[model samples]
Target: MDVDVFVAAHRQEWDRLAQLLRRGRRLSGAETDELVSLYQRTATHLSQLQSWAPDPAVVNRLTTLVARARSVVVGTRRATWRDALHYFTAGFPAACYRTRAWWVPTALVFILATAGIGAWIAGSPEVQASIGAPDELREMTRPGGGYESYYSSSPAAAFSFQVWTNNMVVAGISLTLGVFLGIPVLWVLLQNAMNVGTGVGLMAAADRLDVFLGLILPHGLLELTAVFIAAGVGLRLGWTVIDPGRLTRGAALAREGRAALGMVIGLTLILLISGLIEGLVTPSSLPTWARIGIGVAVETAFLAYVLILGRRAVRAGETGDVTAGDREDELPVAA
Candidate 1:
């Protein structure tokens, strides 16, 4: 067999081994030794066969050998929970940092602006008069009257369900609205911001500012942040279509596609968790001080993660990753 053919066949076998290693599995020492021995033997034979043109039978045998190696790998494999999460989280930094400059700030700005405007209107008499009553939003705005009923009626489960339902609704709206890209997402954000701002402003105007703050701040902080993050991801995706860089639109999009998954997945987790937190804790009997402290911590942590930590992670990946002939670094072979 020609050395080149043998080398190529053997290289395929090596790749199979690498993939198995990465997949990971429990193996006895002797089993491992035997596999290694088989690997070395295959290597030697390929090396010997490479220089000379081998007959068809030899080529057939090499193909069979490679197939067998792959089978052994597949048979030995076991999926670990740890590896799945590792892949998911490993991709998070690259995903978030790459698009943060656009989405993060934009999301925050949208939330802040809408909330601010609604709050202002709530505070303004003429504007409030112009708008008339708070609309349906006002009915939902009351904590003790409407919100507390969920808890008062069914202390154990209703609050949790309410929090989950509300948070999920917000997240779903944010995520689905992302389809419209920046503008659609922006609209959804404004709607919620206004709802939140007006609701709170009305409460404060009614002289229940402390109570309103205490009721909403706890879970709203996390839920709102998660929605903003999701919006940011969608905005980034749309922006890619609108403003592709040096690369052709298609090429840049393809590149971004791989990174986009992480952001979406991460956002999914955030919403689910935030929903749970909102349903269970937002309507709780927690004190004002506790609520404020929790809100501050939630906001601060989110800012640090999305803006600071996320940035560092992406920079680290871009600088540290090697692109050249990293063939040997294929998936690790299981020990």
Candidate 2:
């Protein structure tokens, strides 16, 4: 953190980058590669000085240099379809896998809470009564009633879009709201659990639990898993603020925030698939087992995608963040 020593060490790389920037984009391939390396090093050094030393003159100069380097490096660069390919195949799943610690537990708790609430409502006449009048509950849970009619209420495509939008809103909130110490994410998740649990309780009370499962399981499995992932990511983001673990708070948040944003895009697509199942499969004349079978198939594939591809990507040094050129390098510190 000694300003003089820090500056002395990295001054050459900064000077070299500045020299390259003045070349007006006429550099050779080797020079271009060096420019990238030096730029990254300078960027990292600048982040450190600004964060740890805070010398106005040095920080400002390096900031300007890094910005100039970024434009030169990124301005002519284009993100191809390959970039998108890597994002889905590696970046997105890797991020999700890394969050397994957070999300796996999140899924478990949600399932437990839902089951527990369902049991309470189903067993306790008081809880069931509080939910709604007995007749209304019976009508809602009755076979071929509100629950079954819901999936067929709209055209399949339109219904899918609507369902996707609604679920995205929920998942988006779960992923983004975790920054507020994750409290809001917990609340959002709790509300979902309660709603599902209420349905289970009502269905069970009406002796139509199978009907409820048949309708929801068609899409609920994947849809809710995506939601759990978002909530888990959010909670982790909030926790990052508390124990950034060697990363400065700003650094940790920046890393996780970017990763969460990527998850938003990934989850958006995932929820769309679930919405399709909800709209098309849930209301289909196909046997209940077939519908549920389709849902289970996709959910299983998704987990495998995360566990197999995501794990491989993570072990291969992917942090689920954007590509190296797109992200900032953390400032290395001495112990």
Candidate 3:
């Protein structure tokens, strides 16, 4: 087919389609019908031109035009503030609520493990010796030593940004690694637990457990909660691999994977808040109780947000998954 002859035949139709796209007016029913018809014909014309070697530049222009028209015909979903609003208010919370069975027990196990490790380390002199030299351990655990000094070591603003970046990285990894059947998630949790336990044990042995608690509790409660939620959601994602229930493993993985990604957004913000508390409140001159109270209050509000709002969202059928219109359409399978 002569490219020029083909172009001449369809130039009017292509121009009209381009005109309609540029106009961006509300298409009347008839106009909408015309637009669809024009898009289909133009698509076919481009295909014919491409089958024979058409002018490269013309092919490019047609390619762009076809893509734009396709968007108009298919209807693009532009994200608005309302979408973000819905994500936080409904999607994130519902996801958290639905996965509470996984995360709540996760939180319990982590706490128990942390406490047990702390107690064991505190009770055993041999454990303390294995941790570090006596002088180094004392220097860190002593009141006003490395334990307290670490928080105020850097400027508050810089420190907070650093903490936020670090925690977000950990949470991101925890959520993404869930495809491995949650073993890595468990390792992530265990590493954190051991670190927390070691700190508590060292401080308790030094008779400065109160000071350690004061520094950590201010941010640790919320910070650790965010971590646990990431771990639990990741675990759930990995579990989808093992037991997909009604859905095929791939389908279940896709569903839960999307939800885990959404959880990352929520956890990022949660970790940010905790980072602020660590940088600002924990290191501030506020009394220990006041600092701890702030942490507790913030943590309480977060939990309430997840439980109350999430429960309601779930009840309303929010799955923390993207809306039906937003997600990819699935092909039907033989039952």
Return model 2's CA RMSD, one decimal: 3.8
Which is the winner by TM-score between candidate 2 and candidate 3? 2
Candidate rank order under lDDT: 2, 3, 1
Q: How does model 3 fare in lDDT? A: 0.88
Top candidate, metric TM-score: 2
Query: Which of 2 and 3 is the better model by lDDT?
Result: 2
lDDT of 2 by residue, 1-335 (tens): 68999888888888888999995459999999999999888878877775778899998898889888888888756889998899999999999999999999999999999999999999999988887887887678777787778889999999999999999999888778899999999999899999999989888888889989999998999999999899999999999999999778877898999999988879998999999999999999999899999999999999999999999999999988877777644556554
Q: Between which residue pairs do clashes occur in model 2?
A: none
- Output candidate 1 Cα RMSD: 10.2
Q: Model 3 segments beyond 4 Å from truth?
A: 1-73
Enumerate clash totals for all models, in the order shown. Answer: 8, 0, 0
Estimate the TM-score of every prediction: 0.60, 0.85, 0.80
lDDT of 3 at 267: 90
- Per-residue alpha-carbon lDDT of candidate 3 for residues 1-335, written as tens digits (9 for 90 to 100): 67778778778999999888885488889988998898877777666565555688778877788888877777788889999999999999999889889889999999999999999999999999999999999889877889899999999999999999998987888899988999999998899899999999999999889999999998999998898889889999989999998876756888999999978888988999999999999999999999999999999999999999999999999999988776643434333
Candidate 2 regions with alpha-carbon error over 4 angstroms: 1-45, 55-65, 73-75, 329-335
Instruction: For each candidate in the order shown, give its overall lDDT on alpha carbons.
Output: 0.58, 0.89, 0.88
| Model 2 vs. true fold: TM | 0.85
Clashing pairs in 3: none
The alpha-carbon deviation from the true structure for residue 188 of candidate 3, after best TM-score superposition, in angstroms, is 0.6
